[model samples]
Target chain A: MKDVYFMERDPYAPIRHCYGISKILYEGKSKYQEIQVVESHYFGKILILDGVVQFTEKNEFFYHEMLTHPVMFAHKNPQNVLIIGGGDGGILREVLKHKSVKKAVLVDIDKDVVEVSKKFFPTVACSMDDPRAIILNEDGFKYIQDYKNEFDVIIVDSTDPVGFAHVLTTEEFFKYVFEALKEDGIYVGQSESLHYHLDIVVRFQKALKKSFPIVDLYTTVIPVYAGYWWSFSVGSKVYNPREISREVDVETRFYSDEIHKNAFLPPNFYQKILNGNFKY
Target chain B: MKDVYFMERDPYAPIRHCYGISKILYEGKSKYQEIQVVESHYFGKILILDGVVQFTEKNEFFYHEMLTHPVMFAHKNPQNVLIIGGGDGGILREVLKHKSVKKAVLVDIDKDVVEVSKKFFPTVACSMDDPRAIILNEDGFKYIQDYKNEFDVIIVDSTDPVGFAHVLTTEEFFKYVFEALKEDGIYVGQSESLHYHLDIVVRFQKALKKSFPIVDLYTTVIPVYAGYWWSFSVGSKVYNPREISREVDVETRFYSDEIHKNAFLPPNFYQKILNGNFKY
Candidate 1:
């Protein structure tokens, strides 16, 4: 007998991926979305929300390190950091690596995701007990409206632009994010894939450009993701992401000084993407 | 009713990908391998050989450009080029763009794959009619043993190290390739993915290092391939592939001057990979 678990990336398209499920660890419905945790033969512990893969223990470091470190290292002195929609605590783990970070606050809409992650993904959720860490069980969209120039670095580690997370990609929401960040604060988020989600990246870049002084895009390959060339969008008020201002002293599997310099897309290719002339 | 075509990347591991096939253009078995062409809703026309996807019309440029141009431009003057196992003519098309090239030779074991590509993939196979092109239906292993110091550049565009193509990755075969090249000649081939096929890459690099003076590795992202981050192994005699020696005069969708510099993996990461310490 063979066991297979398939996840459809898009309902309208005929593309799907499957993983050999060794065991089903947890399954339930949160107030916001469906949650699932499973053990796989290849990727180890896997987390799924609303039928989309969030992270796997095998390669979550690529996504978490690329998402958090680029923007964190780009800033000069990041003390107060705000993370939106990362209940899995992977982002929190990477943020706490910086010694200069005095406070790290995470606001997530789903409390069940945190509980499930703490139970199944203990390594990723280990940093939640740190004294400098703060967890808020509230909607990120509603929580950011109250913050005004309170953070040195704001990282939005949200899901795809669908369901309850849809508003997180809009221009109005970015305006609130811009206002919530300090005058010299930096912001970064998971923008989506350059293969299948170029439109979303372009829309988010346009919205971010309207509120920030400098905006750029970088990419890293995540094997289990639907589109392998995962992208991230960065917006800065006074710093340039191309130059790393701080020393990387943390122990990492993928992030490095040379990778930080080479991760950004080429200027010509980025211009084509911005002009909507990118072939694929 | 729904139409679906699934391709399992590995038999031992439970990982598979599928595409919604709107139409099947051709399906037949040759003396070498099984060939199929299908019209996909998202990827347009896709070519599959022996249940593995070779390329798709939507993103073939990423693979072809990355495979052909890095070595082509790295050399001072590539007047004569030989491509082994590229029956689809995509690599041939990119090679013909340089006016300095006087002859382009392509050899493949499967004649049926060439016929199917010319008929179903006309755009990619367009350069077959060029006066400078030569096509041979013969096995690459036996054909290269007779040549010595013949070509300026030799590209082994063969499939994965399986079935009839398995001999192409052996040390004795690379010895023949080293003898078949000029004093400063360059050699490059499609190495497997870094995510799943790292062992094959490590083995191939070890084999190539015995014959060539300088061996390097680079990567590109192909969305439809089983592993998105595809690797390429290059062996050079004199020139360093990290620097471009000539100007790129061809029109391309993905390859650029800046991309040539950024496409290679960072030295630190490559060292980790060579040391067998890469976690992901």
Candidate 2:
């Protein structure tokens, strides 16, 4: 069989796969753009929604934890937050756990993903109907561009950097993130895998480094991702992502202050990339 | 579809997985018991070798790297070393890179894995036919039980605790390991995933804690196994795994002293486990 490339675009990150079709799970508008377990030669069951991989037999928690915690922990008093492209509500659920975060705004291009997640992935992506959450069916890039410094923390929970989500990984989008944040605002977005998308990660790092004074890259293990381990390039307007405290009020299954401190400890292979000795 | 369970009895550890046929990659013997991939609705890919996963799409490298590097780097002079159950030769390739390591002995139950890895995974599992290496098709458990404290370093590069490998993760086997160490001998092995298999990891940890005075747990990112982030438990008789001098002799695509040190930073969840809380 020959390889076929599949791309799922969200504002946060996009998933790209090259595989022959052996099976497809679910496909329709049910709250979320849901798809069932397909015939995956590498991984068994792959769950997709609105072109984004929601679950797999392998690993998913790493991506969920890394995407939510660092920025949430960095903000000392993140009362209001905005999540662009997280229709599945995983980020919203994580944000709601922070007692200090009184309100959240989730903007997604598609409403089908939200509906699907509400039905299937209730435990993880459950904050869809939270009292503190405001769901907006809109374009995240344009939404941020039109908004002011109104958010304490802004998380771009989009798909990969291609198709609709392509612009979100650029310096132009980060400028909007900076403009959309409070003075001490912090931003986190989906950085691709180091193994498969090394060049893309390097480009994002460069763009974020130029846009923000303090930018750091952290990674997690995600089975369905091109590379099992996925990275996030973080940019902050005022604070350093390094200053971690034991003052987190959120109850998380995977994150803690110790993890917050440990996340910054990049592998030497990655250290070489940060030090400019290694490129892609 | 009915679920089928497979057991991978590496000389070190043994792992069992329940999977659908879609999860099975390759079966039967070629150069190695090469299994491509199998999907699990819950666990991800069940990478079977002779009906067991030698290297799944998930947490295989965490075990492989941790078992090879700590002891290889800790010794001031490691001229000769013995590896039991690393049939895939991933560890052999890592050991060969240390210019100080002149000879490496790899003992495996199946020769098919070694031969197949020599063909497919040539990068990490390369150097199968190197001049400085010896491939032994024998029972590693018996081999260790017979050999006295002769080698500088001995690595347990086996599978999980399922079938034949179940003996390798026991106290009695570790006693054999202790006997097979030099005055300053070091040993490392694949414990289990800190996320899903903490019960096994804790059992392995408790067993090693009794055998060796110094026992530590470290982690790395592996996406294809049960969990994305995987942990390895290390046991030392006299040397500390963290006392690494930043001097690296061999060029590496992945492993390094810097990477070596970071691997020991257990996540906070696992930190609680090591601290005597095995709740997760």
Candidate 3:
């Protein structure tokens, strides 16, 4: 068989990441965006939304684990956990691994993304049937406005901050997130690539710093992403993700006790990034 | 001007990185390989050897600093340093930063690679003519066999472990390297990408472990590299690269004392990688 490549062009970056596609397993347009499930020789199944790689079966764990467990393990008692915009169920799967988590709520506005993910990615969408997971097919921003000091940990797994997910990275949304969290709640979100989106990361940190007492950044390499050095921003009322408060007895290939401590950028990186004093 | 892209294809990985090029400044067939210097709108000047990108002016510091300083700082005093196959002189520039380093020698077999770099990449090749820096255009393997416990630090910034550079990553060459370093000396080399070249990294580490008592891995991200998580293998007789023995007082855009400590992999990663106990 000849080869076919999917070129995922970044909106602003001067590079276009090309992925080899073996076959198109499923292709259809959702209400908010076009969706496709494709088979890759190296990466197994890949989920694409609006010509952007959402995740692949081979390395989704890097993105999902880094985004989920750091915040989950940071809090001393993360009983009530909330994941925003992770319709793919990968975050839910990771969240359910925490024994301390009593109720895990997942909120995504796009119901079609959830339906498609459930139909195509069974292993990645594995935790949908778990007893503790609560699914909400509604706008997370509107849904979050009604709460006050509710969740112990809140994670935003939204797409890049250029679309409907744009509001989620704003000061107003962070203020809403501040109101929705407990006195000691921790908020974590994908802050995009630190190499390509340093401006966006600093913006997110600045906005979160207004509401949360502690804000820092950590990153992991996801091969599918353009810059590969994908960043995750953390906002906490008390816990600093660089230091884990709880002992991790969970099963994870990438995030270990050492990795948790090592994943964080040194204080100098945050100083340079947040203060807009650095350049790539 | 119309846009042109330089497509970098890895022999194994499924992805081909595309960088936007403004113009091809020079193209010629060297005695050993074909070389081209191209100007990029985003990455400044890019040096490509035989269709593979050597370094771009934009982010070479990420690679050069990580490969050089980890071991350089780990050594209490690195008076004499030797570099193998770093024709581009990025490593030489970083080696001269240490105040303790008195004599820095760079040996690359390809004279054209050095000549081309000196012409097109003046800023990156800035330290090639420094009083303390020495250039030797000769076969490194032959030159290395003459030394016995002479150099304080030896760095192998060779190309990927393919073609002529293959010999540099073998057990035999590591033995030569082990014999060439003083009792308290340190060694470092680019071990390729962690994601795409895990087996190569493990193999290099395993080989170095035979001759050196302490061997570890460190990495930095390069956007030009297929896998942005680039790995550098360190072998030392007395120094542990994770902890620095000397204070770093260099003017760098990327490397700092915090970065020096942060660049090395956590102990768990080394354990998992060395035992071949993990998979991506």
Candidate 4:
């Protein structure tokens, strides 16, 4: 057996995180990006796309639960939800956990990612066959533009804001997301590392402020991510993302009602970060 | 010029975070540990000891501020302070910021760690010559056994609890620390990462629980550290480490009153982690 390792380099920063690989479960490319399913030395199985780690078996709940629950709990009743680019189905699994979610539409451009995830990561892709899930193999950028006042919550779980995926974070695309949502809707997307990509975080938050009344940034410690301080940007029409409208009633490893509130940056700290007080 | 990279392989896990190096400022070994001061491509100068990153110029504030302030503010009148193994002098600089601190003594096993830091990291080592500060080069494990009811606060800023440093975290050593502190004293040490070394954290906190009435864990995101979510274990005799005794009147980049409270894990989340609720 040959010793193999996966080098997860951050294009935004001059650093990388390396993971020792025990076995390569699957390796192939979709029409849009490269994909791989590798059994890791420590973190069980890992899903990698375009040279970036999407999640690991041991740590998927941190990213999935955070990306899903805050938005779901913030909305009064998330009867309908839109998940863009979550082809791995982790977000869809979390969204369906909400009793209020009548339908969850997951629009991902890469069919191979979903297929490989369903094949290699059974636990993460466990909820793909749920009746409430509506999987669409199309670009969410185009799919979101077709709906009007449809989704109660919209979550962009796409790759980094680069290449073709860049459109998901643009102001025009934000307009599409705002229009696709109901009058009182909540929106969120995984931004870059808060430490490495402050400029992008500020830019994304400022752009969302143009279309939404409430905008905020929250962070979590992702073990496999480049900086470990992975961030999520939130935009809400009426409700504050910091306040939870629903009590947590789902099975989760990381998300609790208290962790939800504590996860968001304090107002003064957030303002200071936006004001460029941080030199790092 | 060659492109050099610093591979910080975590001894606890089969993972490493790499930093691109622009220049090597210093590389040598003291009697205690191997040391290096290097200029990084994105994170400015970094101080490395025994293949582990102590702090980087770009993001030292997050670690230093987090390690210093909560214990400082938790005490009503923090007049006498003791620091064990903070050779970089970053903790000394923050400790000197409090007007209430009348005397601060720092003891380390390696003099080279202090010398190289003063030469290459002048900003971090700026307060070395303070009149009220005392610098001693000795093993803190042995140096701590000499005092009884002496200091208001005691902090251990040493390397990871490995090799010879392991003794500093033992229950016997914690008993020594308890005897060295005043009736209303506080103690804090750099525990392992919350994400990677939960077992070590639990063990250290459990050990501290035997010596102190109030023992808790706090965390902050350190970009260059192994897991990024660096944690500190705190034990106090009288004061609740969560409350602030004095206002933040010092100049700091990251520690504020709200962040001081926010840096701590929520009580329920902390309990859940202790109860083994989280998988990651």
Candidate 5:
């Protein structure tokens, strides 16, 4: 059979990526963004939103595990967890791995993403039906306004900070998140790449520093992402992310005790990145 | 002006990259490979070898500093160094930064790359005329066979292990490299990306292990590289690469005291990668 290629159309990235597709599983428009599912010859089944790849079956574990486990293991005991904009349920599946968590609240502005994930990505969307899961189809920014010091952990697993998601990185949204978290609560959000989005990362870190006592950054490599060196910004009210406070016993493909320590950027490199000392 | 895109045609990589070129500076076939220089809108001037990106002025420091400094600092005092296949002279520029090094030898099969780099990439090719530098136009595989326990450090800065460069990763070639090094000498080489080239990395590590006391893997993210998460395999006769034996007093954009310690992959992760336990 001849091969068909899916060329990504990412306006923000200087370089683009092309994946060889074996078959197209689904393609449609969600109320929020364009949705696509294809069986790739190299990366297996992939999920694309508005021409940007979210994850693939072959390497989603690296993204999902790195994003979920580091913050989960940092907290002493996270019983109440909240996830923003993760309609795909990959974060929900990982959050449920911690036995201490009694409830997980997921709020996404788009209902179509959840429905499509349930129909096409069954394994990734497995935790949506769990007894501890609470699904809310609403604006996550407005949803957090009702609570004050209620949740132990808040994960912003949204798309790139563009269009509807741009507000998620603003100072106002960070203030709301600070008010919604407990005194010892931790907040983590996907902060884009350190290579292409260093300015945005510095802006986000500056905003995070205004709201939290301890702000840190960690990184992982996701091949599907246009900027392959993906970054995550963390804001803590009291805990230090450098040391894993709790023991990690979860079954993961990429996260471990040593990896947690190694995932963070060294202090000198981090300072250099923020100061714009390193040229890309 | 209209934009022209240069889509990389890498056979080994499952996905390909496309760079937006503002102008083509040079394009011709050398004795060994096709070389091209173009002005990229995002990455500044970029050097393309046989349709694959060799380096860009915007981000070449990340690759050169990461590849050269770690091995240089690991040794207590490196007086004689041998570099194979770094025709662009970026590695030579970095090697000359060390004041303790008395002599530096560079061997590459192609002379056109060096001439083009001297004309187009002056900053990278600046060290070609240094008093202690020796530029050789010969095959590295054949040239290294003449030396025995003569050099303190050997760096393989070759292109992908394909076409004419495939022998650089073989056990036979590694034996020659081991014979060319001093008793406590160090060897470092570009082992390809950890994302798509795990099997190649494992083969290189296994080959290094047979010839050295310690074989370690370190990583850095190079944006121009298709698999951004690139790996480097290091083989040391006596020193453990985890700790820096000499103080890093050189001026660098990426390598630092903290970075050198953190660049190495943890033991568990390395074991998992070699065992093929981690999927993507």
Candidate 6:
């Protein structure tokens, strides 16, 4: 009974520390689930279940900085960008910072995630309602299949590759992404961890390499993820997102030109794989 | 008692479910703690602690690749080098890969770490007993203070700069590191994480920038550390590590000429801090 109560209270929290959830506020919405700031005195909480960062409080910049700057700055010119699965609207907010960006389309499976994020995580999930922002609630992979080769940069800001998002990392999905981009387009998406999912990352990297000219793997520290350090496979053609330049002036809090280049720097394992030693 | 058992079963582990521990199989007497891959079904147990990796199942090129290739290839002909706290000898193995090395010195507070590593984790810690290597058990900070204007490269492979190792990142310590290096020496050290320990990283970056002319922060995926995405800070006196030659033919598994340049690239928070935005 206690465990069940704990799960209901903080289902997504670290198992040992679930008892510490302290509700700040909870407000209901018609379309979206709800907006709340359920604080965990021990570990921070940001209820993004339906794709929203609903309870973000302490370190929003950590996630925003990591997911945004690396992919955006890696390209020489990220004028037209597409965000897949980031219904929370955080990616769109970051995309608007680049002066070179002329348009950004956010395609998420659920519209509720965007609505919830806009209402709760205002600091990061802002700009969801921007006029240039086109919100399409549908399967991101399917959307990309029909979406022409219009985007220079594609940021796949999906959740854990489990449940509905699991198919996002498949070879078929990546092939579609490859077809959806311009010649020099770059694809950046979450690829999980170095500890539990090295094989998963290896498969994704190998698959992306098969499809793209350059496949670079980089990681960032996210408290909620399985290993906290999450990997990202950047599939590129002709242009490395890191090499691209945007003399564009944009006010950014976490990502910069320097960080942009470092984001593509692969960890030790990938470096070995590139050189043909996969034993790690 | 069960909780304590779990904690001890995975003492250094910060997370559960995705965490596992492998026994050292050997301990004590040399510089610091040393271990072997007695267990570990997930990350494959080829453990690398204190810069010494044990190759129980296969060669651990990933550890050496992530640590050395990035830095060495980035530098222009690094002849003289200093290693702070890498007593376990894995770094020594990585450094010895470059034929350009004229001299190498490794300093650790505890010589036991070096000794145990020398005995058990040999393949990854190959150069621990090298005659060309100058191994010292004295404090690295004190060693740096004594050698003013001595080395071309300095690698700080110390434990996290908290608790006992906290002084390593202080302004005084960085000043000593700056003084110990030649006019063009480059310094790199583990800077913790961007997820949980951004404050510490930012502080270290601030201190390094003040101590050295150019500073860059980068990361690698090490599952044991917080966020799995561990941070690294590079400090240079007169030259950028990026200017180093890309053709260092070290028999490495991870770092390549391209990876060296990529290592110097910063992610978003790295750029933000370097550009003077430390809020996030």
* Residue B3 local lDDT, model 6: 21
- Candidates arranged by TM-score, highest first: 5, 4, 1, 3, 2, 6
Ranked by lDDT from best down, the candidates are 5, 4, 1, 3, 2, 6
What are the runs in model 5 whose C-alpha is more than 4 Å off? A1-3
Question: lDDT per residue, candidate 2, B9-30, as tens digits?
Answer: 3322111222334344444554
Candidate with more favorable, higher lDDT: 4 or 6: 4
- TM-score for each candidate, following the candidate numbering: 0.97, 0.78, 0.97, 0.98, 0.98, 0.69
Q: What is the lDDT of candidate 3?
A: 0.87
Fnat of candidate 1: 0.86
lDDT of 5 at B113: 90
lDDT of predicted model 2: 0.70
lDDT of 3 at A128: 96
Give the range where candidate 5 chain A is weakest over 10 consecutive residues by summed lDDT: A271-280
For candidate 5, write residues B24-80 as lDDT tens digits: 999999888999999988998999998899999998999999999999999999999
> After superposing candidate 3, which stretches have Cα over 4 Å from the reference?
none
Residue A204 of model 6: what lDDT? 78
Q: Taking the tens digit of each residue's C-alpha lDDT, what string does model 5 give over A38-125?
A: 8888888888999988988888888888888888889999999999998999999999999999999999999989998999889899
* Model 2 residue A73 distance off true place after TM-score fit, in angstroms: 1.9
Clashing pairs in 3: none
Per-residue alpha-carbon lDDT of model 1 for A165-252, expressed as tens digits? 8898888988999999999999999988888888888999999999999999999988877777888999999999988988888878
| Candidates' chain B TM-scores in the order shown | 0.97, 0.79, 0.97, 0.97, 0.98, 0.81
lDDT digits (tens) for residues B97-132 of candidate 6: 788887788888876666656665566567866767
TM-score of chain A of each: 0.97, 0.82, 0.97, 0.97, 0.98, 0.82
Choose 2 or 3, whichever is better by DockQ.
3
- Cα lDDT computed for each candidate against the true fold: 0.88, 0.70, 0.87, 0.88, 0.91, 0.65
Tens digits of per-residue lDDT, candidate 6, A1-280, equal 1111112222232222122355544445424244344545444555535333322456555566667777676677778888998777777888887777788999887776666666666765777667777888888878888966888888898766666777888888888888889987889887876545667777878778768888887765565554455677788887655564555366765455555555554456456655556544
Error of 6 at B55 (Å): 12
Count of backbone collisions in candidate 3: 0
